[model samples]
Target: MAVSHLPRTSGRLAIIAGAGALPHHVAEAARRQGEDPFIIALSREADADWSGFDHATLAIGDFAAISKAFAAEGIDRVVLSGAVRRRPDWRDIRPTLKTLAKVPSVLRTLVSGGDDAVLRMAMDLIEASGARVIGAHEVVPGLLADIGPIGEHTSTDDDLRDIEAGIAAANALGTLDVGQGAVAIGGRVVALEGAEGTDAMLARVAELKADGRVSSRRRGVLVKLCKPQQDERADLPSIGPSTVAGAEAAGLAGIAVEAGRALVLERPAVIETANRSGLFVLGIERNARERPR
Candidate 1:
């Protein structure tokens, strides 16, 4: 079968900027591909410069409003990227009648957290509005990390054991919608993240170690994974140089993430910092199950 490539300059592109550095990266890549991206900034969740796109709009959780804005700009190609802060409480939604009507159905499909279903629904909505939702990575292929340890040094025996143990524990916690991250030392869990967030979880583990609740052979390990059935387009767990700083502060020997499933923002700097601190930063697949002792 002969494949036909769509001309890169063929259509209008819209960037639904959320938060963090990903959206900006996507926008830059879109410009490189010869499309002037129309940026829509999520209220308080996206960068201020996002408003400088060819056309821009600000909205909270109102999907209908977002759809209307896209329609107004005549955008037929769209890409969504960046960090969206999950809101369990719906008080601030201010939903339009159209969005309100879909809320019950979305909630029924979504269950608790994880935005995969919601993004799928949003993609459906975008398609219905006569636009195609493109994969965010297609615009920025280099952002994907190479599969491996991703640093200068290999993990020590103790570091490897802790990494495996942390991955297993994190996977278990993810099954419950608790979180995708955990801290461990000597093959034992010291802290499990929840709604409080990763930094807070690290602090809690540090406190527990100070109080002699969890002991470390030398230090601990931080492991983050993608929840089973997680939406890769959104809500994927991410780490970077700051994570290494957090691990150092909490006396962690290493950090492990699910290979190809986790996002490593600021890759060069993150790896450099990890190497400088003698921290092991490795990636493993989801089924790289920790062996039984």
Candidate 2:
């Protein structure tokens, strides 16, 4: 059944958990706030640590089942978090009369779009069934990166120029619904991240560095920013410890994210990793980036 109106707050939030520490963190953080979340773990994607929570397991493509679970548990709000690597396979979709109505758009969305468009389509599917979809940052406020540089290394003048270049490249890529990040070396783009994700993109850069394709003077910077026309509440670019490791392996000088917009998981570990690897991390302010530094 469709909801008449989306509730402002769920009496009990249903955390639609996926892979990674994020789902667990969101659950724990919400509990500390006295807002206990019910874990709806996606099969094979979520971890087994959700044992204590009021929870259920379902397939990513189990749209009808997911809705039924939420309705049965009296869940009002649903938060989509973690990495869902592959989009739902068309054959995996088990549609009811309600979801069958969504088939036309669903089919088109599943086969013919970039990450953001596909994500928006999936969120719309959840909302169509009377559940509200919110970003993970809403549940775990501390996940957003802070402004300025973080870790042991600081940005030098050359690094700052590379950072600025990376930001412009990232923004341009995002406008085309391409990806969230780009690697800039000495004031020019060396690589752009794609559906393979940031890590894969960094790996590509590493390959380039090994092949002597990249500059010998200075390593590049990885700039991750929110898409210019993105729905911030639904999807935002994220980075974590793994990101730092990838950048390090890529021979990157530093990493930068949009302050208060992008999510950073395992922040302490991220900082530690970056510092140990001699790679700097920064949370850049958009407005400040616009004017000459």
Residue-level lDDT tens digits of model 1 in 78-189: 8877766754244444345655464555555445534556566566556666688765655555455445677885567777777777878888987765689998788777
CA lDDT, every prediction?
A: 0.71, 0.80
Q: Which candidate wins on lDDT?
A: 2
lDDT of 2 by residue, 158-246 (tens): 88888889988888898898888999997989999887888899999998888888865678899999887887655678888999999
| Candidate 2 lDDT trough over 10 residues, lowest sum | 1-10
TM-score winner: 2
Error of 1 at 268 (Å): 1.0
Off by over 4 Å in 1: 1-9, 47-57, 86-104, 107-124, 289-293
